[model samples]
Target: MKTIGLFAVIMSAAMTVQAKQVAPTSSKISPATIDQAIRLAEATSKEGVTKKITIVTTDNGKSTDVSPRYTVYLGYNSMAEMGNISAAYLIAEDAYSNVTAKRLAPGIYQVQYKAYRDEAGMVNVTKVIDANEAFINDNEIRKACADDFCDGTIKAAVDVQESTTSAN
Candidate 1:
């Protein structure tokens, strides 16, 4: 019984060490980038236009890239607003852009954000949600929120059709 207990304890220790060896790290969107997105959203909202900020992370948690690439989409109703959003994004991207990584679980998150300005001109985040492997190009997810704001729900990008859908 003593030998059996010792063996079990050894096995448990080994398993714990192995699990720690392969544990994933947490990499979050930089605070600067988040602030930029919020600022942009607030500015646009004040003008009676809505925008969506979709941040697509490169690696689940194994990347060493300190500066992650990002794409911004503006729901502009005219050509004039195009230059404004692009310029703002470029400035933000140039100055403050990167993710801070720490120890956490592995995950590939598609983070969506929406912000608005209050009567005092303070920027406020209206919605923020994480959806794994979200197809942002799909209209269902792209237009999930009305032009004004998002409902803060993470939705699936695709549906499973066991019989009709092709495996390819």
Candidate 2:
């Protein structure tokens, strides 16, 4: 009887542990949603308009060229209004422009650029001023927003999803 009782207790404990492990308390945001937001932001900026730029990666002291599959858009302070203005533009990898290259890994990168808007709304563009593979991911972009650029509203939405899943 003693052995049987001990076995039952052990089984119950094991089952509980398994249940907890199977159902994680925290949930992550969907990759698609994050990707859409990034794409939308880029589309709304000047980078979307030009649609040109290139991305390069280096591996083990060897350089490899990668096509710029992603587009970037920049937001700036609007001169006529109190709010900001954003422009969408695009660039292909290897294009000659202000965009500079930053190395993130042997073969990965994140490209950054500074876009400008004139009083007349003429958009002048820069090229990859900075690059890192870390920044290329959507999660990194979501976390990087400490200012008005990425408000709390989006974070709240993500939190809500987590809570809803955990409750179930």
Candidate 3:
């Protein structure tokens, strides 16, 4: 009985460790938002679109629209920094039209998305704005530790330091 109990405890401990390492996170954007983002990318012209899309927050708060970007770049820096390509991709995709959004004060998410024309995307952006908004609200630390890997920030700092040393 003692041996059986000890074995069970060991197994449980191992399982817990494994679970934390592979913990799953849901996508920040909803299916509706994804659809709208996709449509905005597909649209060829903006025409007479006059609707403002407001994205609902995960915490039931409303997202304030800051400056909209007509051109965007895939946020490779953020992705390399965060090491969570999935989450980065979602934010980038959503950003194609709406660009960046301001959630918490003092933090402006500058993660870029694939560049799409500002004029054509506004209509789809409005359509999705009434729904949920996808934005990068996570801070650098959170993004770096998203998958529990947690070494990206340190690695980035080291790389920067090395570059500086080489330049000097």
List runs of model 3 lying over 4 Å from the truth: 1-87, 92-100, 104-168
Error of 1 at 33 (Å): 17
lDDT of 1: 0.25
* Model 1 agreement with the true structure over 1-168: per-residue lDDT tens digits: 999999986565331111101111123345454322221221234444343333222322323543324323211111112221210111112111232212122222122322121322212111112211232322343354335332332232321111111111
TM-scores for every predicted model = 0.17, 0.16, 0.17
lDDT by residue for model 3 (52-126), tens: 212222212234553333322112122333232222222222333334332222112222222323433322221
Worst 10-residue stretch by lDDT in candidate 1? 15-24
Give one digit per residue, the lDDT tens place, for model 2 in 1-168.
Answer: 999999986565331111101111122333342221221111123322211223322111213543332333211111111122222122222221233443343222234332222222222232222212212322343346423353211111100000000110
- Global lDDT of each candidate: 0.25, 0.25, 0.26
Off by over 4 Å in 2: 1-69, 77-83, 93-168
- How many times do residue backbones clash in model 1? 0
Clashing pairs in 1: none
